[model samples]
Target: MRIPGVPPAELAELNRAQDRLSFVYLERCVIHRDANAITATDEKGVVHIPAATLGVLMLGPGTSVTQQAMMLLADNGATAVWVGEQGVRYYAHGRTLARSSRLIVAQAAAVSHRDRRLDVARAMYRMRFPDEADTRALTMQQLRGREGARVRRCYREHAERTGIGWQNRTYDPEDFDSGDPVNQALSAAHACLYGIVHAVIVALGASPALGFVHTGNERSFVYDIADLYKAEVTIPVAFDVAASGSTDIGSDTRRAVRDRAHDGAILHRCVRDIRALLLQPGAAGPIDEAWLDEDAGDDTLRLWDDDGAELASGRNYAGEVDF
Candidate 1:
């Protein structure tokens, strides 16, 4: 895929360093490709979103996006996610950054190996509670208990500081309308955090279905990564937004979470954390084209002709055909 203005070298650099891009969230807008830019139009006016420089685009309720805009996003390595109100629910996701899938292989290996998987899980717990003395000795059950207690304390502290009534989190997906404003706000904030974490996980080519701290479901890994940042980012933001008594609690919470994410450089932190957790120290460096070609055998590889049709023989560019 040829990106129009950017040269090949610069484009490669941009694709490799997507961790530096900022994240944008859009709701109730129409997104379309305008020349080389992705333009979003709302009742107010049209605004150009720098898709290439975006890590994630959260498309919330009432968002309509054109195919061309999606293609542009895919070409530029930006992830687009369809979400519910204030990003409280994830509906779907677009194409991920087409880089090497070595990270995915490594992640799968780590998660599938019983001993290493436990180590990775412990690493995740240690990251969440850095002050914990001995994460290595704690079983998954003990870790869960500690995490639950820590989260409860975070809720209590935030509620006290923001003067919002502290209540157990209660939300009915079937009837979000009937849920408490505080619960709704908390859900919204956590959703944004999850979206961001999910995008980073996908960009790194890691399987979201595989998780260490969290297990089961499609977004288990996403939940695990988002938990690392919840107390610092979403928890407080939720409380503050709810305390403000805003009529649009969900929108207010999402906006505050976005601001906090930007201020905290959460995407960069997520990237660093994922690398640290998944990749062992002194592991082989980033996978290269040669490594990928060697790993993908001839039977699994497909050779394409110039007209976008697959050739009969499974051959690569070297012209040394494999039958």
Candidate 2:
């Protein structure tokens, strides 16, 4: 007998991108399916999680997930990410929620055009420095320099408020422990932020590798998106956690970031910000019209036409092609 995959109606009932949790981290547990929910069984006990409500599932070291559990996660449009031992480093990610290619197409067009790309980059800087009036005359480099100064000031202020050491941001990528207490906390905090940002990016069907300001890395777009919230969310949280002088700074930082994400509705804000950056202004079409309201990841595939337009898929165009 064929197993019933997630029915289209059930998939529609799953939580929207903005309404879900930012992410959930699981480690050293056996993740298996239990009806509609997934269970994580450890030495202590089994905990049941409603898989449909889960946004991103981070599987860390020593975790064993069953096949049925994976099926449920995919069926629910929930992204599963394989993470490092501490749950900070990302190894890989699972399926995306989006089935339409509209957001990515818009993203590519924006990146390909120099003026549009610069405008989007400047808008990103504006998101970071909302109070900075009159940035229209500033170049990208100048904006970046100003942003750096602003971030530095944010760090110093947080340090003073939390009584944490105010030092330069320094970290050895190869060695997490090599950084100062605050730096280590910052790294851990940033990792959580990256995970949430990445989940939103993929869920929206946008390319994470294509970035406006950040470059090269596969997670360049993830970094660019996460930077919008660093000063307001991660930086202050990192410093506060560092000031507590917890032995398990990484774990503490993750929890704090998660709490902040919940309080700030980070996922919702992320969806809005990404849509604003990528979606074209005054774009016309069924797909564009559908997205203008909010993010709706319906599985509507279209065929690309040579004349820079899209046509409905699944049509027999042999006669038209011959002509």
Candidate 3:
């Protein structure tokens, strides 16, 4: 997914060269070129993207392009265009633009909050350590105590509820070693959260760094959003799937662990939950328009209008391309 806010300055044009597009992250075997092919690089040293398969290149503001690249891009189906941090401003090819002040405001109001998400994360963590006397059923709100009694209660209860075998023991964060059941569950929870957040980032079309809730220099906006769904979806399923896959919850279980997180129904529910979260008023907020703008938005992001039309509000939309 793309970020909602653009960088403060113009992107640096590092280089431009011609290369045949082979499929990597390419979702489909389609490609387009706009006038001059410009290669942009962020300060983070991540390579800037070239034209994408099945996606039209929308030039940003102050963007320079050659007529030849533009002709090839448009003719080859660079569906629409966007200008600067704003959004889709034009349809250089056979595409349309959409967006409005009301829409932006609505989208900004729909993302979820940190405290609630942390609560959910804590819950998932407890489920994984069900048999531990010091870590189950504890909410983040109650995690501040040095004794961690609340967490212990939750863990004991979790063990009882799941009827799982466990060593009734106190969890000392320091005493834990690799491949311990508790640690394994926690790792799975983290991975599941990562996958879910990545999916959410893809859906929202917002930069994972420009987040609504979790914040830090090490920004993983995708991880933050996905954290919200872990307790509700990913964590539980991961545990069950992992246990079912192997008696030992170790590296051998990682694939099953990842697979449950990626299960179609679970992922779909997570996506639906994210969409619902983002659409709520001031909870998660509405979808960002920049996410849908061909210039700034990730083309994979999908938005719907009140009229049930599959389009980004106020930004022109190309026909839907199912992943």
Candidate 4:
């Protein structure tokens, strides 16, 4: 009944999504389980983190994590991500807390159907450009064009405002340092955003690859969702970091992005927006506010009924329906 390291210990009991921490980044440390908390020890010293409330544990370059630490994280429904060597790229991640297939099922249904896929893409565009009242009628190519122009204008405006150099948005995933300061900052900021969005998508039992706006890549849906906030979250931050002339652009950009995301209440809004996108259509009505607080591993399974209602699962209905 008690959560491990969080004060008063109430995570496993209540499992409130907002009660958890957004993320914690650790590098060049040996991480292991210490009592109810996780300990990260380095030449700098040792720090203890509340594993119960941790959402994503980003293990960066020169980091070593013990199996005991990983087990503790898994038990507490925490996500552990192994990041890039210089720490600006995403590599892999540990398990998510999702046990229900409701969101993923909805996502698959929408992605498989052509009209539903376009509708989801339009909904995303609407979320990005809330002022635009005619996104519903825009074709995919038109939507892309609008988005491209908007992003270009955003970059130009930010560059002018900050007095920072901006030629174009270019990132070499294989080499994070090949780009200039602004580009490096942008890449780092976006990686952080991608990590957060990917964490949320998997936590809600949605496929990060089955995207509506993007495709082919393993994290296509992560890109789709992260693009929703790039203009407001990462673009300006990257430019501002470059303007400050920070020697360590990656670290500074990440800190700025983290602060902005927190101040903007992005985590809460991310969950709410994801639910609005995937869980709305084919439902009886709008989802309640309490759905945002759903605990991982609730484990309710139902048969997908294309006709209407949710049928009971774990039964043979071969004789009841047609082939």
Q: Which numbered prediction scores highest in lDDT against the true structure?
A: 2
Best-performing candidate as measured by TM-score: 2
Compose the digit string of candidate 3's lDDT tens values, residues 131-232. Answer: 545533454555445224543564455555555554544333333233446445545445434533443333233344544445562334555555445444
lDDT of 1 by residue, 107-133 (tens): 888888877888888877787888977
lDDT of 4 at 208: 88
**Tens digit of per-residue lDDT, candidate 4, span 184-211:** 9888988888877887787666888999
For candidate 1, the C-alpha RMSD (Å) to the true structure equals 6.6
Candidate 2 lDDT score relative to the true structure? 0.85
lDDT of 3: 0.39
227-283 per-residue lDDT for model 2 (tens digits): 999998999999988899799998899999999999999999998888878884622
| Model 3, C-alpha of 72: deviation from truth (Å) | 19
Q: List the residue pairs that clash in candidate 2.
A: none
Which regions of candidate 2 are displaced past 4 Å? 1-11, 280-292, 295-299
- The lDDT, on a scale of 0 to 1, for candidate 4 is 0.81
lDDT computed for candidate 1: 0.77
- What value does the lDDT take at residue 93 in candidate 3? 25
Candidate ordering by TM-score (highest first):
2, 4, 1, 3
RMSD per model, one decimal: 6.6, 3.3, 16.5, 4.6
TM-scores for all predictions: 0.83, 0.92, 0.37, 0.86
